[model samples]
Target: AALRELAAKAPDAIARLKGIGLSGQMHGATLLDEAGAVLRPCLLWNDTRSHDQAARLDELPAFRALSGNIVFPGFTAPKVLWVAEHEPEIFARTAKVLLPKDYLSYWLTGRMVSDMSDSAGTAWLDVGKRAWSPELLQHSGMRDDQMPELLEGTGLVGPLRGDLAAELGLPDGVQVVAGGGDNAASACGAPAISPACRARCILSAPISCTALNG
Candidate 1:
């Protein structure tokens, strides 16, 4: 139904869709196994069952240095750890971890990939350097192989799957693009305005306040 709506709104939807830009809920963990099957319902960014794990990770100097951010109940790393400790069987079988938008893109394109900006919020990437933090992954009880290949927000994600295009009643090979998290995506359009003022602000997703130069 949602797919139909997506098609309905865009005339010649698939062909007209030059590229897809998604702004997913940051920190939501979507675990998939080797077969590409979802292991369980995603623990969304708002879920707080991992609060204890987040706090424990916050005190780790190594994590702080690598990620340049503190672990929070809403971040992906502790959510992964929480699953590992409590849902051991599922965690054991998990072969790929995706952010929310990446999971949607996967279902659309059958490709497992992520974007650097979105990955930054996971507490598993060096935000300053824009790459996965191996040491942090190790400490979080996650394997390096389980992560999706990261891309920049502007990177190409190739064509849309033929079947999906056809199903949506349009041309094949519509291009896709890697996208960023809510804050990062929004930041792309946020005007600097004036040095003393700000054009935009994101309440969550790092709670950052960037003071732009006029």
Candidate 2:
């Protein structure tokens, strides 16, 4: 919403600029069903008002060793902290702080969930074990309660939420599978999935095979 507003407000200025590419940042909080529908403002990924918290977390060796990711201001933890510290009013009202994928899934399924791949992108997960890292969450001044339930990559996420399904004219009970990160899903398709094939690039043959089988 904010991104669209910014783009519309300065299409020529923003679109004409070259050199470095620019993409709008959206607030993670605004993605939730309750907040999104209520017109809650978002906190963009690049909004670095949480630099102090991010810097503090960077000093914790356990964070890097466990998560295998640096505490960058763009990640959710920092953005979350920024909201908590600066916008207590909004923070108090937040139901959950979700990542981009999780946010979209919420609107689709009318359920909120975090899969391993998306969770790994946040600095709060232990990628090796594919679970949330307590230390990371604690250091970020967030609680595990703030995160959605973690599910495997192949798990059945849930059926589409009623209102959303109705809006899309999808039948009730339609399955909503847990989708992977786009690259990972492409990798799992066809020749890439086989050990004998080594194309070194994403191939569509496997995707076609899966689509046909389904």
Candidate 3:
């Protein structure tokens, strides 16, 4: 496949690309169907040509308050806007827009979804409810129709689509758990789950030791 070919050539080409100031790579997988056909080329997160859209969103204090994060051109909504504006042809062809992990889940299960944590990063979700935020979408010049359905982080999105499973040499009915964003997963991997414990360890390691003893 094209990706395999790219990967094979990347090591040699990456350094040269870096030298030319085109060093960035997006960390997402391209989804494929049961027939091993590419659904679409995966959009890389570092594609930041949506600076205008990002700037407009960033100007709104509501964006930061609602999303609990600053608007960055690298995030999904801006990227979506970029596609809509610059690549209307591709945008028109898109059946679904998904984050990296969700795209993989789609390939595995033939389901399209927007996981809560990833949605939170998109500037398209109501952070408190963890659902699509219609107001944010409207403000961003996008419609709710353009967004994927939402799913809780621990919820079952679907099972692996049978033919895809067989083709991948995986068993049928592999459960596709709605996954969280990279940050949320990384937090779950930490030594302590509690905020106080983590804060103590991070702020004062000696204090964490004392607290552990006492």
TM per model?
Answer: 0.87, 0.66, 0.70
Instruction: Identify the leading candidate in terms of TM-score.
Output: 1
What is the clash count for each candidate, in the order shown? 0, 3, 0
Task: Please provide, for model 3 over 57-158, each residue's C-alpha lDDT reduced to its tens digit, 9 standing for 90 to 100.
Answer: 889887887777778887777776666677776555554556777766666566677667677777777788777777777775566765668877777877
lDDT, candidate 2, equals: 0.62
RMSD of 1: 3.3
10 residues in a row with least lDDT, candidate 1? 192-201
Error of 2 at 39 (Å): 8.1
Residue 136 lDDT (model 1): 88
What number of backbone clashes does candidate 1 have, counting pairs of residues 3 or more apart or in separate chains? 0
- Evaluated at residue 210, the lDDT of candidate 3 is 26
Model 1 ranges off by over 4 Å: 9-15, 192-214
Every candidate's lDDT: 0.82, 0.62, 0.62
lDDT for model 1, please.
Answer: 0.82
Q: At residue 173, give the lDDT of candidate 2.
A: 62
